[model samples]
Target: MARPGPRDGALRPARRRTVELVLVLTALGAFALCLAMAGLQIDGRVPERFPLYVGVVSAAALGLHVTLRLVAPWADPLPLPLATLLNGVGLTVIWGLHHVRGTDTNEADRQLAWTVIGTVLCCAVLLVVRRPQRLQRYPYLAAAGGLVLILLPMLPVIGIEVFGARRWIGIGDFTVQPSEFASILLIVFLAAYLGLKREVLGTAARQLRLGRVKIFSLPRMRDLGPMTAAWGVAILLLVGTRDLGTSLVLFSVFLAMLYTATGRKSWVGIGLAMFSVGATAAYLMFWHVRQRVAIWLDPFGPDVYTEHGGSYQLVQGLFALADGGLFGTGFGQGRASEIFASDSDLILISIGEKLGLTGLVAVILSLLLLAERGFRIALGSRDVFTKLMLTGFAFLLAFQVFVVLGGVTRLIPLTGLTTPFLAAGGSSLIANWIGLGLWLRVSDSARRPAVLPLPTPAEHATVTMRLSGAHTRAAENGRNGEVSSNTRATPQG
Candidate 1:
């Protein structure tokens, strides 16, 4: 057990950090491109003040991100880049809207400030949580904390009801969605529990034969203790505050995690059945749920409120999206001015309108690419904890994207979850970065030597070529000894 020499410990991180720095620089370049397009849309006169300030702040934040990432190179990769892109788009859209409205500083200023705070917070999480496996130490506590956060606004002492839902818990000038933070905590608990319980749950269920195929025991009854409890909490939240979006998103997240942990299609079938029953019951018992269903069914239906009513946000969002057509109205020239409340949940619609179908498709493609990369990292990593965490992180991003886009397009009832890292929300911005940090850690782990103890110096020299990020020795060792490391070219400079 020789300690890693100072040089040995520092060199790899330094090299990887160079990669992280390159990533930040690329982000700055993206922001610059967006600003240039924005300036062009504004008659070649960039909002001299706001764009410049945003550029500086964004670059500085990205620099800090790179530095912290060097310290924890194994953190989540997709979350940070995805967050940067979405947040960048959010700022651009907000800036464009401000220009159209003749605002002085632009709404992007606030978002930029939040981004800084979020990046710092993400760094803090990496510093505190050295490993993902330790999170299992308090799964029930985390779940309870999530429940409290979701139920915080229900208390009469400090709740403010807005737009017919009491989702926000304000602390002075800052408004925080307790549920947003709670969702991640809940996911952590679910992953920890499911990972530990998978074998028991998988083995307990009795196999059943129905018609053509046989199904092994699905953990429905064994899982009912937890699943029923989650359902009860969700229904309670919906009953008390009527936050349909959060409830739906939370349910789907846990359900997906369950299937992934067990690798059982029966769980998926059971989940769908339970969800169908829940939806029917919810629609019958709650007028708000019924109204949401109606809107999703027909966004333009007359029975629903219009212009000055509940349909206003979606209507305006649809208009902006339709207005963009294909290539978008050349960046900032689109007519999104009429869409009130366009920058938050429905920002994608604004982007669809302004960036056009190409932009919309590109955004979706980017997220899919991110999800794919994350799963690759998870699959490559040797540690089961890292694998599960990265897989869950990918699931979180995939589901969030699906939920938000589905809502905006009238494909599903709109949920309140802010588009991860893109929408204007402090909790989401920070949480998304934390997710990315975890993924980065897992991916880093994947790149390391896989087998146990390192051999003597003589043996090491034999594989020196393979040690340099290329498995030249592993290939040479074909029919030789056990291959300890799986190497691929990673930029060392």
Candidate 2:
């Protein structure tokens, strides 16, 4: 038989890889179908460069699968497919919006380009970070980098003010949301810090008492440094940048990870309480915060709706959803293009309007599944840092979805936060893809089969002597079978 080439070996279709291929194809087909539906509903024809959209989606999806197989072969297959489906949904929405508005195709094309960039970065992370546990070594460095990212938008010359929030920075003609990437770095720092201190924070706390009745144990003040720092960071975001969304997300994710590490439910309550105080202070202090709350309370109000940059987007988004009801308005049949900021903060509203409640639920369920898979991956990991880091990514994503969806649905006050994998922001997409890469890395480690190490040089010498002795004895006596099995040593190649 001829030898198998290295290329053939790399391209081998194992069981999980096969499953991934089927799912990726399924996701791509669904997106193509949606694209076609949008085209026919709007312009009474197939979309311009229809095959190109499908091709891009297919290439990105397949490329991710191949990368996973080559680098993180033991990773769970579901995440890649799940994220691809969500990304496809976003692309379909973007396409529908552009077509209905009769805008140039560059916006969606720009989004597609961003998707490719994000995927490439994701693959790069997988290639670079072989042993994710090593990330624990640079908690401070991660913290510094994260702080810089979030704060960069506050710089006068570089910062770009969109509406009132200053959470973005200008790079030539492009604007980047620094907080999106900042969240991941902060999560990395939190994971590393909590991994080291979980035992002490969980079990070594001093118990508190209310006279006769015992209250909860109090964590030592020194032990509470990370918590305080996280709280300060959240408050700074809220107060400095007027970014309620990022502040809430960053703080809430940290709290969830903290509770997971410590197994202390009280920490959640404490974190919420602290966050509430900050929120109230911001509401009292910042007019933008007050306006958001007011709009959330009554989006249909005449005064608020008519006001500049008020509830027009929210009201329009709600009306679009009402139009969607059970089934959707059917692709491009509705006026999603009329809704302001429909691509980012209102992307869910776009889904709700076009795909209707049923499709909306499907998308939300996809988010839930992705988060579930991430948590499950964290649980499968043996290392504490891996567990916390995976949990942070999963929780951050889940909380982000919650906040954005709630805002769109009027369940909570709206703020500026992009949907992961399903929004049009390049920085957010790239950051999330990077996080997804980390998830795959840790999952691969968790799922990889246990491999025993070869003997050390000293142990190898001892084993060699035993083997030689047994062989000589058996040969001299001409009784190989008579050699004691215990005395025989087999040295592995």
Candidate 3:
């Protein structure tokens, strides 16, 4: 037989190449815009520092992309590229905020350096995680590690307290939030746990009888135990540590992932019940949560908060958002960065104020696209573990987006959580990049062809015999009578 030509081997489906090119270009465009906006924002205000920083970060991100293309050409076509662009945009916004505040650019420099470090880490994950099934071997260990990380910030005096929340652990000159990495670890645990329990959860039994109605056994209760534990931790964080928004978002993340895994309505009901209980408890015990509830209920009411009481940040966020109106004040032309800590957690309002509703919608749409593509990756995957893992990651992104955007717009009470990829945080950037990398790996597996073992002599003989029988049957039919009733009744045709 003539060998297949190199061109035949090289020819890939056009759709894959198109997706790859589109993502690459989109990432470049977003990165370029971010650089332009940052430079424009810092014009004559700073000592010409951000330009070099943006240059270095941009180069590093591009280099990572090139390396991935060379090393894993079939990888998920979207996540890493989109993450790079979002990270660039985040850095640019942070740099702009620094310029406006006249603060030192050292933080901005550190952020850029971390971006490089995080990109390297992402590459490492891509290289290390060669298979999806490998993660299922150590669920307990992963879950324990995640729990330890969440509790680390509460250890002695080593943990740093910021904004009344002990979510960070300061190491040397760098501060890291263990909760961010912990979230990823917990996600892995959830995927493994839920994937295994999905069958059990799918089976239903009667629990109680009332008249003609009987209560179906919470078959999903087995699956809900870990999530309930997660909810308890989140509630503790909300009431004790005053981080209500993160807790709410985390609950949503777990619920969303669970829903995707089993498509169970009962899980949603259980999550909602837990959320309601948590919210009521939080409102009763925590002054901050109570105050937030008040602000959320009556944000625009007369004298809603006493000057700097509860509604100050929401008030300010609203003012900035309203000021942006429709078309916005133009890039680098808003007053959002003048507010304290605006660049890190409240950067969305800053972007809204400068770029107007158009920019805000653009960012939201981009995130939606990212989440949609992530879910697409998950759905396309044949491996159950990969599907669950990818879906869980996508759930995290969607939940985070809803939390931050809802908070900024006062659709929900404001939380201090930073936006993923777009907000300035070392832990968040690192974790998000690692996640995007894993997503890429899953997507690659979805697209790549599996290698089949070559047939043995016996197998070859079987195949030959089947083909020979088919030929002999056809010849016999041609030589003998035409199609009979039995042949007509056959299903092959």
Candidate 4:
């Protein structure tokens, strides 16, 4: 039997889009099921608005999926479906909470609107960012833009103080968290800058030795300028806005990217040491930081729980989670709304109370899958900038989830970071969707097949003539007993 040629191998089916469509449908179905269950639990029947809500969500998901098919056909199929599922689940949870509590505020409606806006913004990002590497051209510009965005909320005219954190800019009854967008831009700058400077940063300027054995390699003080500057900026932002979550996330992402770019463990150690010291100092000097630490330590204490701006919400969250055992109270049956900011800062608790340990694990696993896909994209990427950027994004998502979940579970002090797709916030939703779009773009590039250049007609004719000449020479040699010395081998050029 004859073996198949390279063309046959290249002709394999491109079923990425088909797989994506199937996953999208599954996600939509799961979302609709969640909504239905919530409605049944709340009203003992499917809510009248259930069909309308599902239609809106289906249209949004289909629109985004179609956009991906058109713009990034070769992209990884998992991130979109995972994001859609998470977003849909979040909407269902918010809707259940709002109706169950009989709250006057239309938070669920606002979240729905934001979801639509976020989906549109995600599509826009796909259209604008046709290639991921193009972002590398303006590292400085991105850095400047990121810094400006991070600091925009400090402006007295527009800055709005909420829950004692000045992290939002008010615009005609709407608030925007500039740091959410700033984080991505900063990652872009870091990826580009670190990709270009990895060699220098990786080099060991000094070696620590003990008894003729090298202990470790340390970068030069001069080489540490960038890291120090970044640290200072993070500290300044934290102090200026008193937003520990944004500061921690931004610095963590930078450190992750720096370590990834240079493969230097020293950088990690240095970053951790710096953060620990800064955190200690902040805890000692800042009342808010001290209060947060106190709440983390003694959330159940009478004095701590009842104090103004105390751990009431945190304690309530714990009660709700504890009330939910293995399987939970079920959708729309838990009193999660007793906790303030239940849909935003305490969304994880809301999920925990309604869905229990099993559901929480599923949500976390979904996020992990998304992060894994991103890391896989980074691994497959050929460009250094693309790899670093994707790595930064993966770390960002991982760190954000860790901070939010840890705070909810009392593993860490509350940092006011919203859970990515599950939290109710327009800025976070839009920014994350935009990040997802970029991930799709990178995945498409990484998975795309390399195009081989075809041979020109002139080159093909030359090869044909050479073959004919060789054949003629062989025939002549056979006829004349190889007496072709005068032919000079046709120069064989």
| TM-score of every prediction relative to native | 0.83, 0.90, 0.84, 0.92
Q: Estimate every model's Cα lDDT from 0 to 1.
A: 0.71, 0.86, 0.75, 0.87
Candidate 2 weakest ten by summed lDDT = 1-10
Segments in model 4 whose C-alpha atoms lie over 4 Å from true places: 1-13, 211-214, 456-481, 484-493
lDDT of 3 by residue, 1-493 (tens): 2343344344453455557667766776776666675566557343366457656766776667766665666766667666766776677677777766777867778788778888888888778887866897888898899878877877767778776667788889878888789888888887888888777665544455577786434643455566678778788766545667667766777787777777766777777888899889877877666767778888877667555555766778778888888877754566686665677778888778877899778877778888998999999998777788888888888888888888777788777788888887789888888888788778777776665567788988999999999999999987666567567778993
Error of 4 at 270 (Å): 1.0
lDDT of candidate 1 over 1-493, digit per residue (tens): 3444333455565566666566656666676677668777875766575556566557645765665565666443444555566667777777777777777644677777777777776666666666656777898898889889989988886777776688987788777778877877787788778878887656545677787688555564656676677677777887777777877778877777777777777766766677677778878987777777787877777777587766667776777788889888865566676666677787788778878899889778878878888888878866555566667777778888898899988888887667766676677777776666566655655654333455788888868855764666556787354443333333455
Q: In what order do the candidates fall by lDDT, top score first?
A: 4, 2, 3, 1
RMSD to native, candidate 1: 11.5
Top candidate, metric lDDT: 4
> Which residue pairs in candidate 3 collide?
none
Instruction: Give the number of the best model, judged by TM-score.
Output: 4
By summed lDDT, which 10 consecutive residues of candidate 3 come out lowest?
A: 1-10
lDDT of 1 at 291: 76
Per-residue lDDT of candidate 2, residues 163-257 (tens digit): 67899999999999888888888888999999998888776366677997877767766777777777888998877788888888888888889
lDDT of 1: 0.71
Which scores greater on TM-score, model 1 or model 4?
4
Model 1, position 263: C-alpha lDDT score: 79
Count clashes in each candidate, considering only residues at least 3 apart in sequence or on different chains.
Answer: 12, 0, 0, 0
Candidate 4 lDDT score relative to the true structure: 0.87
Tell me the alpha-carbon RMSD of every candidate. Answer: 11.5, 7.0, 6.5, 4.7
